[model samples]
Target chain A: MKTASPFLELEAAPARATVWFDGEPLDLPQGANLAAALLAAGVAVFRHTPASGAPRGPFCLMGACFDCLVEIDGVVRQACMLEVEDGLRVTRPHEAEDSGAPV
Target chain B: MRQCDVIVVGAGPAGMAAAATAADAGLQVALLDEQPRAGGQIYRDVDRVAALRGGILGKDYTEGRALTAAIRRDGIEHLDGAVVWAIEDGFCVSYTRAGQAAQVSAPKVILATGALERPMPLPGWTLPGVMTAGAGQILLKQSGLLARRAVLVGTGPLLYLIAAQMVRAGTPPVALVETQTRADLMRANRHLGGALRGWPYLAKGLAMLAELMRARVPRYTGATTIAIAGDGRAEAVTFRSGGKPRTVACDTVFLHHGVVPNTQAARSVGVPHRWDAAQHCFNPVVDAWGGTAVAGVFLAGDGAGIGGAKVAETAGRIAALKVAEELGRLSADERDRRAAPLNRLRSRQTAIRPFLDAAYPPFAEALAPADATLVCRCEEVTAGEIRGYAKLGCIGPNQTKAFGRAGMGPCQGRYCGLTVTALLAEATGQTPDQTGYYRIRPPLKPVTLGELAAMDDGARDAAE
Candidate 1:
C-alpha cells in the first residue's frame, strides 16, 4: 500500500532534520510544525481514541481540539503545538495508556 | 510571585493588540501564549507564513503581519509555550512552560484567548479523516498542505474561505456540501442594509463564492442526513441534497459550523457570562471597553464574542486603553480620544455580523446528533447515553457530568460542553442557559505533579 500525503512544500525549503513516526524516518523542513510534517509524510492517523478505539487525526491544529494527541519521547503532547526537531521519536498512544495532560 | 502592570493571555489578534497598546502606553506587560510564536490561530505564524504563502491565504491573513511585528517589538515581555491552566480571582495566573510550573501576577489581566470551531457532533466525527475545516487550513498555513481529496461540509463564511484557499492552493475539494437552507439565506437578507454598510466583508464572501463557482467543484445545498461513512477511517460522505440522497467519495471530510468564544479562562476566574440568543451560545459579559464585572479582568476579541480579526484587533486596543487609563498610565481623555477611531472601525467590522449569524446559525440537529453518535470523544460517551441520563431527570451539564463521565476527560469539556448542554436542553424542557455550562474545576487543564512541585521549588528559590 502506498502512503497518502496531502501536503507538499510550496517552496523548495531544504530539509533540516529527521523525525521518526511509528519507526519510519521522515525528513522535515527546519522549523516546520510537527503536525504539518507528519501530515506531509502521509502519517494521518495520529492516534486512536481511548474510549471507542476509533482512529482519530488532528482537528483544529491550533491546540483548541485535543484530537491530535501523540506521545513524543515518552511524554504526550499536541503535535500541532510542537516543532519538529532532529532525532525525535513519535508514537501513537494505545488504549488504557494515558497521553499527556490536556493541551 | 512575579508582578507586572498587565498580563495578556493568548497571542492572537486581540492579545497582541492589547499587549502592544499597553506596553506602548508605558505599562509593564507580559504577553503569554501557548504557541512558540506570538500570532494566534487566525494569524498563526504570520511573520513566516505571510512571507512564504501570503498570496494563497489572502490579504486579511497578510494584514496580521503588523500585529505580529508589534508583538515582537520592545516594551512587552513575550513568553511563548506557556500553557495557562488556572486564573485566580486576585489576578494571578498559574501556568506551565518547558515542564516548569510558575505564576504571573498582575493588577490587570487580558484574556484574548480567541475562539474555537462550534462543535458539530455527527456520526463518524470521531473517526479519523473526519476533521474540522479550520484544521485543514492550519496545515496549509503552516506547511502548505491540503488533503489529496476532501469533501468540505457545513456552512458560514469560514467554510467558503477555506474552500477558496484550497482552490488557490491547486487542491480544491472534490466536493462542497452546505447544510444551510434557502430560508436561512432569506432570513439573512433582512440584515442586508446593515451588511451593506460593511461592504468589504460582503464582497469578500461573494468573492469566495465566485471562486468556488468558477472552480465548478460539485456543490450541494440544503444538505441533510449528512454522515461520514467508512469502515474505521472516513472514506465517503453520505447526505441528502435537494431532497435527493447523494454520496461523495473522499478520504477526508472537513466540517465547520462557525466559531464560538473560548470562555474557559473567564469562567474559571468567576467572570460572569450570558447566553447570546442571536448567536446561539454563551459569551462572557463585558462592557463596551471589554471590562468584565470582575475588575481588572477582561476578555477581548472573539473570546468576548464572534467578531472577526478586525474587530478583535480593535477591541484589543480599546481594552488596553481602558486598562492603561485605569492603571493611571493614560489619562481618561487621551484614552477615549485614541479609542474613538478604533471603536468606529469595530462598528464597521461588526456591521455585517447579524447577517452572517442569521445566515449560518448553529446546525442544531448536527450539534445535537443522533443517540448513537459520540458526543464526548474523550470519554467515549454517546449522545444516547447522555439523553438516557437526562430522562432520569438530570437538569444540568454539571449533573450530567456527574452521572456519566462525559465532561471529565482530558479536554475538560472544551469540545463536549456545548453539545452536552444542547442535548440535555433538548431532552429536558429547559433552555441551554437554564441548563448552564460545566462548573469548571481547577487545573482547568491537566498538569503533572512534577509541574506542581516545581511551583513550590520556584517559590522557595524566590524566597531565598
Candidate 2:
C-alpha cells in the first residue's frame, strides 16, 4: 500500500523491482536511485538517530551526509549511495536492537 | 595490488579530465569513483540521465558528457562504484568495491574529490523531510523525482537554478525563501568588474531567475530567522521577510547556503589547509597548477578550492600536464605551452567567484545557530553544548570530539566541522583559523571490519 507521497516521479520506469524496507515490501523502479525510489514510494523516514533516536532521512543525497543510513544485509550504509536492486532487504539501522521500543 | 602511473580519485569533471589527459600523455591512469557511473555530483549519472533529462538540467550539465566520455579511452582504467577510504604514504590508494577491499599504488595521485553542500543548520532542520537543495537536484537528475510542494530556503545561484529546473519539470516550488539582503548585493557590486568579465555565469543566473519569475514561483528575498517547522517531518517553513514574519506551508524544505571544498581526502593524507575566510571553509593549500605541499599528490578541482566545474576542468588539465612534465613524459616547455591557455581559461572561469561569494554569503544564523538548535546531527549535539565546551576551555573541533562526540560520527566531521569551529571561535573570541578544524585521519569513508580483514595484503607486499 503506497501512502500519499509529496514526491512525484517524472518518468515511469520500464521495469519494477521489489525491495523490503524494514519488513514491508516496496515495489520500486528498477535501477533507479534507491533513496529516490523509496522517497517516491513515500518512505519518508529513512532511519533514526542513534543518540536521540530522532527520525532522519536523506539530507545530502551525494554521500557526504550519513543521515540516510540504512542497514542492508547487516551492514549499515548510506541509502542515497545505493541503487534499487531487486530482492534487497533494508532495515532501519539498529531497529532490531530497538525491538519496537519507542524512539 | 594494482599499479598505475597516476590514480585519479573521483570521476567528476576534474578527475575525468585529469585521467584522460594523463592517459593521452602515455601514463597509465586509473580513475576511481564512488558512484556506479562516471560523473561526479555535478554531472552525476550523466551517462544515463543526460539523454533523457538534458532539456531540463541545461546545457552546462550536459556538457559533462564530453569529459565522461574521455575517461573511456584506452590507457585509462575506470573503476566505478569504488569508495576510496584511505590514501596511505607511498601513494597507495585503498578502496572498497562490491563489499571487497582493494589497494592500488601510483607514483602520483590526483584528488578531484570536488565539493559538498555546506550544512545549513536551523531550528527543526533535523526533521525527516528537510533536505539539502542539492539533494533535491540529485533526485531530479538521477531518478526524475520531484517533491510536489517543496519550499527552497537559503541563498545562492543554485537555489534559483533548482527552482527553475522544478518549474521546467512542471512541479514548480511553492516558494523560494532567500537569505541574501539587498545590502549583500550592494556589497557584491564592488566586484562587478570581475563579474562582468565572467558575464556568462551572471547571465545564466539571471536567466534562471527570469524563468522562475515567468513560472510564477513566489520568491521571498532577504528572508531571515528562517526555520523549519514540523512534528516528525517538515510541514512548513517560517521566516522573516520584508520585516514581517511569514509562514509557507509545504511538505518538504530544501535548504542550501552554498558549497564548500570537500577536503577530507586531501586533509586525510596530511595535506596542509588554510581557512578561506571569503568562502568560510577550510581549503587545501595548492599552487596554481594544483601542486600541494605533499610531494607526488596533486589537488585539483573544488577539492582544492571552491572553483566551479569549468575552473575545475581547466585545473584538471593543467595539473595533468604538470604531472606529465614531472614524470618526464612531457618536457617543461611543452607542459608550459599546453598549460598557458588552460591557466588563462581558469582565471576567466574564477572571475565571478568573488561576486558570488559576496552576493551569497553563508547564512549568518547557520554559521552560529541558536543555542537550542542541533549543530551535530549524528551525535545530537546542540549548539549550546558546543558553546558550553568552549566555555570549558575547548579551543578546537578536535577537542569537541572528546568532550561531546560532535565529530565522532560516521561522517567524520564533514557536516559539523565548520559549524563547530564557528561556534568555538565565537565563544572563545578567536578567529576561525585560530579555532582550528578537525584533525582528519584515514578510513575517510566508513569501511566494515569484515571488508578490512578480506584485503589481500600479501599481494600488496609482493607489489611493494
Candidate 3:
C-alpha cells in the first residue's frame, strides 16, 4: 500500500506564491486555504503549547475544529477554514513562542 | 503530560454535563472541545446565542448556558478550540489548537465528540457549491457566507431545524426536499407523540413548520434528487416527486439525511462497534453507563446515537456518575441514584429511535448518484472509478488504496471515505460497517520542517 501521505511534497513551480513563516520563504499555491496551501508547501505543525511544551497541528480541516488555527492578518482563526487570499500574511499565534500563550 | 482525573472530549452537552457532575464530586476534570467556543453544534456559539436573546433557543437553550457557565468554574478546566487527533492508552490524547499540536493524558476519558453529517450519495451531490446541509449550516453560521437562494434536501428533524435557522438568519431557503415520504412522518407520529408529550421539542418543530409555510419556502416530500446542474458549483438541482420531474433554480443546495457518530477517537482506542441496524451507522454498544469495552474510556452523547441535546446531557450525567464511582468520588448508591434521571430521559427519547432507524438508513440501496455523478470532486473520481475498483477486486478501503489512490487527499478521507467504502462494500457483497476508515496518523495536519525542528527542546523534554 502506498504509505498514507501525512503531507504532500511541494514541487518547485515558477508560477508560485511565496509564503513567509517566521521570516522564512516558502512556495505555496496561488490561492489555497491558508493552511492547505501551507501544508502543500511542506509546512507542518502550525502551533505550540505553553504548559507542557508540545507541538500542535491541524486535525479537522473544516472550521469545526480549531486545531488548524493560526494568526492570519492579526486574527486567531482556523487555518484550514480560511481561504488563502492573495498576499495574506499568516503566522503562528502569539501563543507559540515569545510571550508564550498556549492556544 | 498534564494529567487530570477525567478528560471529556467535546464540550457540548455530554462533555459539559459530565465535567460538571464529576467536578462537583471533587475529581479534577478537563473538558476539551474543537469549537473556538465551548458549545458544540447543538448549542453552537454562546455569543451567537447571547446576541439573539429571543431566538430559537427555547427553555432547552438555558440549560446549555448554565452548563457553559458551570464549565467556567475553577475545578473544571475548559480548553475550547482543541481538535483531538487520536486516543492513546490510558486515555492519552493528541490535539491541535491555535495552530499547535499538543498532548494531554487522563486516567478516565469520556468521548462526546458528537455527531457529523452522513453523506447520502445521489446524482450531482458532488457538484461545486452543492454541499451537505450541515456543511451549509456551518458556513452560514460561522462566516455568514450563504446563498441568497437555495434548496434543502433530505429528512428527519434536522432539515426543518436548519431551514428554520436559515430563515431566522435572514438567508431564506427556496426549497425544502425531504426524502422521507409523508407516510413515514405520519407513522413517526405514533412515536413522536410519546416523545413530544415529555419535551418542548415538538412545539419547536411546529414553530419551524409554521415559519416554513409563512415564508412560503416551497416544500416537497418524497422527493428524489435525480441530478444537479452547474459548470463548477451547483447552479440548480433536478428532482422528482410523484412521477413529475421538477428542476429548482438554486445557487446552493443543502443535502442531508441525518448525522452519524464521528468514531475516530473511539475506534482508535479499540472500542468495539456494531452495525446499528436502526441508525444505519456503526455505534459502540455500551452498557446503560457510558462504559465501553475499553477501560476508563466512556462514550456518550450523539457520538453514541442521534439523541438530541437533552438526552446527551442526561447521558453525560450517567457516564459521569459511572466515572465517579470508579474514581472513588461517589458511592455505589449515589451512582445508582444518578442513573435514574438518565434512565427516564433515555426511555423517553428512545421511543422514537427505532422508527427513525427504519425510516432513514441513508437509503444505502440508492447511493450511486449516476456514473456521470461526481463522487470525489477534489480528485475527480466518479461512479465509474468505483466500478473500476470493484472489477479490480479491491475488497476494502485499504485494498482500494493499494489499487486506486481514493482516500489520499487534503480531506484525510472525510468527504470521500463513506461513499468509497459503501460502493466497495456493495460491489463486494459485504456489510458497510466492515469497510472502516483508512489507517490515520498525526500531525493529522501538516507542518513545515521548520515547525518540526523549531520545537523548543526544553519544552519537548518537559512533555515527555
Model number with the top TM-score = 2
| Better by DockQ, candidate 2 or 1 | 2
- lDDT by residue for model 2 over B356-411, one digit each (tens)? 99999999999999999998888889999999998899999999999999989888
**Selected candidate, larger DockQ, 1 vs 3:** 1
- Candidates ranked by DockQ: 2, 1, 3
State every prediction's TM-score relative to the real structure.
0.95, 0.97, 0.79
Cα lDDT for residue B79, candidate 2: 91
lDDT of 1 by residue, B309-367 (tens): 88999999999999999999899999999999998889898999999999987776677
Model 3 agreement with the true structure over B65-89: per-residue lDDT tens digits = 7778878787788887676766778
DockQ of each: 0.63, 0.86, 0.04
**Candidate 3 wrongly placed segments (more than 4 Å):** A1-103, B53-63, B139-146, B186-199, B358-366, B376-378, B433-459, B462-464
Would candidate 1 be rated incorrect, acceptable, medium or high by CAPRI criteria? medium
Which model is ahead, 2 or 3, in terms of DockQ? 2
Candidate 1 segments whose C-alpha is farther than 4 A from its true place: A94-103, B455-458, B461-464
